[model samples]
Target: MSYLFDHPDKVMPFFWEHVRLTFTSLLIALCIALPLGFVIAKYRKLQAPVTSVLGIIYTIPSMALYAALIPYTGLGKTTAMIGLVAYAQMILVRNVVAAIQGIDPMMIEAAKGMGMSKRQIVFRIEVPLAVPVVLAGIRVATVSIISIGTVAAWIGAGGLGRLIYQGLNHDHTGKIVAGTVTIALLAIGADLLFRIVEKIFSPRTA
Candidate 1:
């Protein structure tokens, strides 16, 4: 409480930094995942190999991935963003594949019967139906990125995690608590926002 009141400037800046890192990485992941996921889902044969590689990347420890990236990208947000984007790939790609593939085959057949081209069937029919699933994936990835963005502080990326690290070094309990609570709240808020969006895109059940 005291720590937060005393340092509103520091707290707010770091919180926004954390937001920037999380959302930027997610945007990159979505851009990469959507096209790749579409191709993999469409071809069928590419699914095993491509997703296997992304899964292996996701399995790597975050710290290890950061350490490996630092030599090339060096310290700062670039390296952190790369690591975070890599982490998001498996989640986004898999969900996208599932969403597109899960669409009703009958709907697709009908689209074809109506003389819709492959592009029209994909953009108009499949992509719209896949929105809920993609939003689900985005929700999961956002939470994960919020958690991971804390570690970005270690590499000088500047986030709420800095408070935790500083408090650990200086033994400032208030700062540590503030950082932890802030992150938890941020994750919860992001989850709720995405849940609302998912529901909006979800099919009506009535």
Candidate 2:
């Protein structure tokens, strides 16, 4: 709309901020989740308890999570990052465990037969084959984080959500539309990008 066009500078910065927050949170989540997931998957006794705990964290309301974090981290990117990472753990951890577990036993055996070390088998054989499913999880987690990250604005973590909140306060329909549209577009674009990356890394289909 003309209003959005007129406010391009104002809108773009907020949109980029939202992207930054979403991506950074996802990256951190991945770092934590991937190793934790692998450890969980490797240990039968720990898997259920760890995953259950993370799932419980995911079910907690976002506002409640932010509020709980505020005493330690205060209102800003730190709190937002904590909330986003917590939410992502459920998805990433589950997916990583499943992906590694779902790998064909024959493939692993073959890799081992080929004189592959344990690390080589895991990194080269198991991980490469699991790329599609792992990336699918990443796609889901990224989209979810982007949607929830908007709530971060309430705590002073600036993003497009801030625009939406401001628009709501001022009854500015145009700004609201701009912010909402930007988020939708971002979610869709990120989903597509991850899907493409998944396909590229995935083994050839017969």
Off by over 4 Å in 1: none
Q: Which residue ranges in model 2 land beyond 4 Å of their true spot?
A: none
Sequence-dependent TM-score of model 1: 0.96
Q: How accurate is candidate 2 locally (lDDT)?
A: 0.92
lDDT of 2 at 64: 94
lDDT of 1 by residue, 1-206 (tens): 77777887878887888888899999999999999998898999999999999999999988888999999999999999998999999999999999999999999999999999999998899999999999999999999999988998898888888889999999999899888888898999999999999999999987
TM-score, every prediction: 0.96, 0.96
Clashes of 2: 0
Candidate 2 lDDT over 1-206, as tens digits, reads 55568999999999999999999999999999999988888897999899889989999999999999999999999899999999999999999999989988998899889999999998888778777888989999999999999999999999989999999999999989988888898999999999899888777869
lDDT of 1 at 88: 93
